[model samples]
Target: MGNDGQSVGDRRGGLAYYELEFADDGAVARDTGLRAAVTAGQVDDVFVFCHGWNNGADSARRLYTTMVDLLADGLARHTPDKGARTAVTGVFWPSLLFPEDDPTTGRPASAPRPTGGELAAGLEPAFPGNKDNLARIGVLLDDKGGSDRLAEFHERAKKLLTTPNLDAGEDSGERAAAELPTETVITYYSGWSRVDGQAAPGLADPVEGLWEGAREVLRTLSYYEMKNRAGQVGRGGLGPFLSTLATPDGCRPREHLLGHSFGARLVAYALSGLADGLVDGASPVKSLFLIQGAFSHFSFNDVLPFDPGRGGALSCYRNRVDGPLLSTFSAHDRAAGWWYPLASMLKRQDASSQADLLYRWGAMGADGYQVDTASRVRLAEEGFPYGFTTGGFYRLDANSVISTLQSPFSGAHSDICHPEVAWAAMAAADLAGEHQRPAR
Candidate 1:
């Protein structure tokens, strides 16, 4: 019941809850007590939940609490005994919120552009080390500068959110974006504004929309930063912590990881870190349920469906989960459906068609796991059977329940606090428990 990094004994909805705070660089906060509590065998099962970008510490807590409460309710109705020893670990990390479209119409808001101070204030926290760069960009925005100044602003913004060499995945689109000419980048940004959340025609003149285009470019850069940070935190902090839990004298509870948006990328990268020899023993992760994952759909694929010569970044880490690896996708999630693809690509003509290009750079949340090995299933109600008996990849079409239009920019992206989703997580955990039990 304490503040983010200070809380370790919080309890909610008849279940023990712990906050595990991590820095952007993937360092765990001191004295969080998650490790000690788990090692003490306080719980037999741990549901580790991580939030994606656009969430503060408080919002993340609310999300975890709400989802965990739903899970608790499901358990009470279905399997009462299992709820007694279960615990929830909510992961809090640094992420920033992007400007959103009108919730009612799903179109760009008509609000005036943010002033220099406003821009700086809004972005300073997310780019902590680049305060000066953010301030400069803000000044440039306010000045309505010429092409030279616009180029400078873009350079500063890009540097502010540049991906670290260690955390850079196999994202050719991202690389292409970084290498694009300033004018082409502006053109892409202008095109994004017209196509963001509406079926609008492309912009008539990219230069005319330079100011808005610059802001859009900034948002894209922030997205890239958040993506990189997710991987960094997962690999450096969460993965090492999980390794500790897997130690001989450690707790070794059946761990079920549930992450939403970029948080899904976090958990997936945690497995990557573990697979890269961070831990010598077998993985402690029993089940992984990625809700509206914000990473590449081909993350678990051995080779890209369109390009056989290349494979996903996390392909080798797919089997790290001892039980099932499930991901949810919804067509209504505009953040994943629209913005994700736009931010991912620089070239508008990369593929044979627009659909092909989107598929090439699509997010897991919008497109699901794009691999031949993944089995597709519907997101069922509480009492329905999931039949997740064995360990493998499964993509759940959550459009039935995750179809609510919460916001224009991120339609139903954050509408995952539903009972059906909770049931799915619990079902996955139950299957993982079955796998962990000694066989006759």
Candidate 2:
């Protein structure tokens, strides 16, 4: 591509790749890749990465590169070799919604609006059928009205849909000219429809239904319930992403996942949404590294998705947090610790405080983050204390090189790709160890 503030590099045959493209002035772009070399017989462990909020492909790539570099480096330093080289895969979900303030890039970040819509619509056919299905439909309907003025879409789609009749014994120009062009109309449809002219209807009921549906598929503290929310696959991008990331050369082992604020909610959902393997059986998760997660707001019922009074439903019921996930790392950062939960008190009509509304979601007080003290106590009584993992390298020692120290406004959300945070993940992966080929 053009080198006007853009950089690109790839391995000889595209095995490893990296690219950096600027979306606007002063906004840096970074992209990197590590292709999987795992053959069916040679496959060892797989790591599929999912990134957090406000990140684009370039940023995700850079994060992944940093993760791979950190992994390779960490492995050499920490644990003993299991005589296997871990493969890494980077899962790039559409992140076009990342904010863009530059006058230069105009609507560059707005590019993914259409694709995001299409992805949402793909789930519409499954709506109201299953709780998860309905939630997806609702999410799709929620974003239906976004403006995308891409003019060339119709012509381009028409061209792609046309195919020649190759079996014809002789080529006929008139026949080709008379052929009707196949056209597929991709319309944007948000999950919400007017409630007698109102845009959002059944909001409370749908949300309640989602929660109830979710309880059927999850266990308290298990990964399944965490990933599903209000009966929908709440983690947004990654649920669809894993299917693409697990192909033969799709991903590697020990890839990194980073999320911020609501993004962290999605990550938690991804972790707990496993229905077939994770909730119903043993989870397929090998390791997870979470930072400044929004978990405190989530209840035990939210995480586990199941009533513990019912015994041993899912086989992967090990409660000790040793292997599958790393202990969550967090700081007393202000946004996560303070500001986020304080916004619930703001009146909806207060334009000045509009931005703060979401902060009240899981926060502390009335019309705010806090659940009532009585309810809090009740939730505690119903809490899954056995859910959390206590084992982990609690502190990043001097001997360790990964750093996640936050700046004044920095908290779990912005720490996703912070050099130190990335390094922390590297350290978590034990990437500094020896690598050996798997035995034949």
Q: Which ten contiguous residues of candidate 1 have the minimum total lDDT?
A: 431-440
lDDT for each candidate structure: 0.75, 0.31
Model 2 lDDT per residue over 158-210, tens place = 22112222111111111211222211112111122321123432355554333
TM-score of each: 0.89, 0.40
Query: What TM-score does model 2 achieve against the real structure?
Result: 0.40
Global fold similarity of model 1 (TM-score): 0.89
Residue 306 lDDT (model 2): 22
* Residue-level lDDT for 319 in candidate 2: 27
Q: For residues 260-297, write the lDDT of model 1, one tens digit per residue.
A: 99899898888876644432225678789999998888
Q: Clashing residue pairs in candidate 1, if any?
A: none
lDDT value for model 2: 0.31
